[model samples]
Target chain A: MTRNTRLLMSMIFWAFIIYLFLPLIMMVMMGFKDSEFIGFPIRSWTFKWYQVAINDMEVLGIFAYSMTIAISTTILSLIIGTWAAMALGPTKFRGKFILFALACLPAVIPGIISAISLRIYAQSLDITPGMWAIILGHTVHNVPFVTLVGIARLNSQPESHIDAALDLGADNVIAFMRITLPFLVPSLIGAGIFCMLTSFDDFVRSFFLGGYEPTLPVYIFSQLRTGMSPEINAISAIILLITAALGLSAERLMRRNKKKV
Target chain B: MQTNDSTVRLQNISKKFGSVVAVEDFDIFIEPGQFVTLLGPSGCGKSTTLRILGGFIEPTEGEVFLGDDKVTKIPPNRRNVNMVFQDYALFPHMTVSENIAFGLEMKGQNKAQIKKRIDELLEFMQLDGFGDRKPDELSGGQRQRVALARALAPDPKVLLLDEPLGALDAKLRKQVQIELKTIQQQTGKTFVFVTHDQEEALTMSDRILVMNEGRLEQDGSPKDLYYHPETTFVAGFIGETNMLSCSVKKIDDDYVVLDWQGNELRGVCRSGTAKEGQDVSAAIRPESISCSAKKPGNKGVMKAKIIHRVFKGSFTSLSLEVDGVKDCILNATLAGALAEQLGDEEVWISLDPDYLSVLLR
Candidate 1:
């Protein structure tokens, strides 16, 4: 290709990226306005909205609840996913295809269907639809995604590693903990962050299963029903900032680990 | 009780992955302090047999006895065997000292003892100052030494090595092979190695088990396997040999007359199993055939023309095709002086029947 074609392609790529971020830019601009309602133009800039969201006890409680659900979902999914992947990835057995299909069921199924099924099951078990329900539903949707990342990481690992460890007198558990686990650390972190973000931004499951409790996404949706307020914009801005920081940190950590290895 | 020459024995061992037989009814006896190599081409059950001996896989059929103890069902963690994998398999996360000390730590050795053993092994492997370096930080040869130290730290009954130096460059591999042999001699541990390289097997092994298609073709000392291969497969696998089809003309008690390409060649039958009017293939090493520009009044000289010449340092290989005989390649080491005038010239080649191996057709 000519230089002009390359330059035009790069410009188009940047344009696509900017288009993706246009809504977030608008949200942040709307967040800083001192007006009672969010609009296109920011007439004034103030810290009052930030203070409002930071000081609201009810909103703080919801944030705490959402954080608890997100963190628990991430940890539980990582454990289940890593274990399931390790058990099924390297070993050969009968019905391996069936096991793989079952493991992928969660990722292929629609999230809302899983949410409805979870709500039905939880109701039958006399477990009320609340924070716990959201945790269970998010786990159902995120575990398979985490398992896929774990499987890819495990499959790329050399089989000689486990054999070497065993030859060095390490049992199965010791080999997994010492050799396999450390090698999977970067992918583990990557998968955990992905699960956490998936749970954090999920709305349909939280909307269907949550009862008398609001996750962050549900809370944002409820705020949209009422007129858009600067306090809500401020919360959105804080969430956006947190996600960007987390993404940058994850990338930086992966790079550092790669270099260290 | 033979205390010094105790052997590691495998009895009717068989392993199958589903229906594919990786190792089938294999048996081997490795004497103590002997360097025995399981030499075969890839997928010929050499590494699989090594892994089975190392206790990484339970045999599907029979038992393993190490100095009278049955160990077929023993796990790799409990077996007194350590393996150096093809890629070295050094722990990328651990320092050289930590990697070497791992086996000792697993055996519940005290930290002080572990440190001392690690230090001694480091010194022995000439990696004394590289204790703190990770496997990736060190060079390929250094990582291999660390792997050796780790496997040797526990002083296991058998040290299993799976093509350990296969990943190195040719020059480095030769140097490390010498160092490994020295280490094996100093330690006097039973070394069970696996490789497909013919030269490596010839140089390193006290005894070599030649395998093919999951079956043991032949097993003997290096000289035994090299000088007298049991079958055509063993003959071709062990070294470079020209296997020529011949019909036995007359077989006396100690002598056999062979008709090859309408030429009657009188040669001694070492094992003397040839019957009269039987077909057999004779394995003749290239170096066994001595070539000269003029007939030297030798017993079995054949008139042949040189087709091609390959100049190897310190030696030369001449490809010869006779008038009524098939092409025969001859290798001679005394090159610049003896065979210089015979290049591209009609030559008479002499063969010693003592170096000939006859196998059934």
Candidate 2:
């Protein structure tokens, strides 16, 4: 209530805000710097790094590959995760808790461990490590998030809606498609965006399972090892912008669905 | 649209969930165009019985018949029945017209026919011009009407309603009760309504089925159940009644003499055997007993002291204590004006022999 306390609270709040955004701000600023080095007082500003990054055929190819894997991962996770959530949402069965915990194991375990274990499993199955393997790894990591969100959405829905649908002459498949699926749209969209972002930003799993074909994140990591460059900063800024736009659109869709319901 | 064989028959239906019996040996025959109510307290199997009729759940034992067809193992979608849920379960995302058109569309009706049916239902339910509004945009009573319209759109043989007006306010509920009965009469469909409210059942149903503890206690016309209850449960459940324990002094073909606190009172025995010298209970409705400040020269008149008088607008309920009636309290419904004159004074109480329901304990 005191003036000093209010000032101190505002100071701490701004410090926390800066702690989160300062790195992002610095990366964005470095993307515009003219110098090859990433840090220090800016001598000049230019879009040369962005141009170079966009013109590099290898970087562009890696970005396209990452987009493909991320999109595939999102689609696969959405289908499998929504199905699992629907099965587990409104019923009681033996070993349900154990099954849920096992489903969530990949999300909670260290990513390095899962990546190594998956590589070993793939090798045992005589499967080659490539884009498919990376996509599989990303899906395992993202399905649990989708399932959790889906379960929360499904649990909040009233059971009588489905009962009413059936009582009004709808078959089982029709009831699910009309009532249950519509009710789950907002959560599905949100979870898809989350899974896509997670897959696009993932590095460790892609590095371990990607073999010769490097994704965008793996390519960035390799560039970092060579030396920090403005081109890497440019790509990072672009990824950040895409993710922010996706998050904003997801929120808008959720609000729109809320109004409809 | 076949109205002749629209009767619903349930033969020896029993349902059990896990170790609990939800309904046991339930049997009833609902004739076409009859408005029957399954009345009971919460968790007393009324809703369960309605659900069984709707084919939402299969009874563990017994058969369900719609017209002449056996439908015990049929799914809900295959049955010619629809239900208005307790919560009015209108789809939140759909407009009122869309919700009403759902069943008709599922029946393979053309778009034009569906639209025409929906318009008719909307007008019938007094929900005209609200068809484009979603459920959340409508009031509770409006949503309930929409739910009813949706269920009736397909013109099924039977319409089931599970406490459909439960979420409305008192005034809205009363209005809906009258509207619901009128609609059922107009549709000429067999309506199976479920509710725990006795007054609603008495006001709306042509036949009332009283259930207690997952078993049917009594089933008859409203007046029949009220005047001739077969058991103590039915007497206590149907309406307000004062139960007085007495010993049977003598038994006749039509009436029985019960000795109540050394006073021999004769009442008609409508159910159960009346053995001489056996203990029994008599259920007398409060409205059947007349109370006067001065002693009346009537055959069944008894002197009792007024313990308390509760003024309930239309009628005053007088709680009386009679001499030698040790553990039993008698209640009489007197006019407010008459009850105001007899304050803390001895009054004469007369029991109508015809209205007194004698039951064997």
Candidate 3:
């Protein structure tokens, strides 16, 4: 309430931010170090470590593979989640709460538990441990987030919008396509970005379900066991920068959309 | 052959939600090119009836027809009627031109025709430069006009409006009411509007259907309802009225004479058949009471003292208490500025018998 209290609070908040970013800052700084082994005394810094990761053909391949899995997961979850949202948008039947909870259950489940269960499920179905398996695991995890965002956006939409479309001589399908789909575009895009980020950053599921071919996260994780190096730090710093940029933009979009409606 | 080209016809329509009766045994027939309004208080089934006409709500029991076709089983999209919702419900994602072009697109109009219609509607609504703006970019009044333009683009058999101007301020509402009436006339479209504002109903409707508690209380013109309300609810709901209890003395060919406080007052018998020496209820508009400084020897003149005078912008309202009345007061409105001499002064008040509505108890 007072100036002293405000000053103290600001200091505390900055301290918390610094604590949260200390490791990420150190990791990024370590990528510029010329030393083979990481240490605080940066007597010299070079671009060789960054060049090593950037020029590595295997790292580049893993990046593309991870992007493919993320895209696939996003597309699958988007379809399933939007349908789930539309089905639940205006319903008032009994068991609706249970149905909705089941749809969102994967998001709250432990990631490792889901990873083990998905690997087992894939095995029982005789689906090999590979890209399909990893994509399936990522989609199951990402769908709940997509559905949650989609439902919130859909519910906030005016019921009369659909009615207006129908009154304008649009059939039900046409109304959804013309009115409802456009209305949901912003939220679906937000959810899509979120799915890609989460699927790209995912490690446990890809580790359990991936084949000899590895995604970027799984690949980085395997490289970590070989021993932590400046090149590994460089790759991680690039990933951190990417996810941070995507997350900040998604948040800004949601805030702007919130103010609009 | 059964339908006589009525734009909309509802026969014995009723809707029950669980134990609640939303609309019961309602029947209305709307002629083409007429501006009709369903006027009632909230929860009086006026909106339900409008929705039923639009094919958005299926009546529990009834037949709905748009012109000669029975459309009771049809959905809203297939029906020949469209609605301007209370909130306007403009598509936020679409620009003004896109919104106006939507119905035309659905009508399968070519791009050229759609473009022409959009331009025409934009100019018609006076939103020419605002064509590329989204709904959120426009003000409330602009959004409302955009919604109206969208509904009108389809050229439907009937246009239903559910209190579309209920969201506007008083000045804007009055302006829009005139615009709506003008548009209805210019387009030659049958418009069935729903509203609780009696003033709005009177200003726009060619015919007004007064409803109360799911029943058709009265169906007539604005002048008819205002001058001769059939029931006490209709009398009170439409405008300010003095519901005075009086005894009918005798029924003339045109007017019924009633005895109020030892004076004989004449009132029109509009509700039911009048009887001799029977207790009755009559509705008298305050504006109908003529105030005189001098005691006039009129048939129904009453000496009253002005209890309070409220100066409304264009008129002054005077509250009067009759000499013989107990614990009761009557109201009279004097137009324009009045001299202070008439304030809080005893004056002779006479009722215009033609404006007095008599009802049987």
TM-score of each: 0.92, 0.94, 0.96
Best by TM-score: 3
DockQ: the better of candidates 1 and 2? 2
Model 3, B11-84: lDDT tens digits are: 89999998899999998887888999999999999999998888888989999988888999899888878899
lDDT of 3 by residue, A122-227 (tens): 9999999999999999999999988898888888888898889989989989999999998888888889999999999999999999999989888777777888
Q: Name model 2 segments beyond 4 Å from true.
A: A1-10, A51-57, A248-261, B1-4, B340-344
Off by over 4 Å in 1: A1-15, A251-261, B1-6, B16-21, B252-255, B266-272, B323-334, B341-344
lDDT of 1 by residue, B1-361 (tens): 3533346898998889899898888987777999999999999998888888888888889898888888888888888888899998888888999899889988999988998898899989999799999888899899899899999999888899999999999999999888888889999989999999989998888889989888898888888777777688988987788777889999755557788878766655544478878888887778877888888875767888877787776778778776587554444433655768774768887766767777776
1 or 3: which has the higher DockQ?
A: 3
Candidate 2 — number of clashing residue pairs?
Answer: 0
Shift in Å, residue B212, candidate 2: 0.6
Give the DockQ (2 decimals) of all models.
Answer: 0.77, 0.81, 0.81
By TM-score rank, best first, the candidates go: 3, 2, 1
Candidate 1 lDDT for residue B222: 87
The stretch of ten residues in a row with the least summed lDDT in candidate 3 chain A is A252-261
Q: What 10-residue stretch in candidate 1 chain A is worst by lDDT?
A: A252-261
Give the Cα lDDT of each candidate.
0.84, 0.89, 0.89
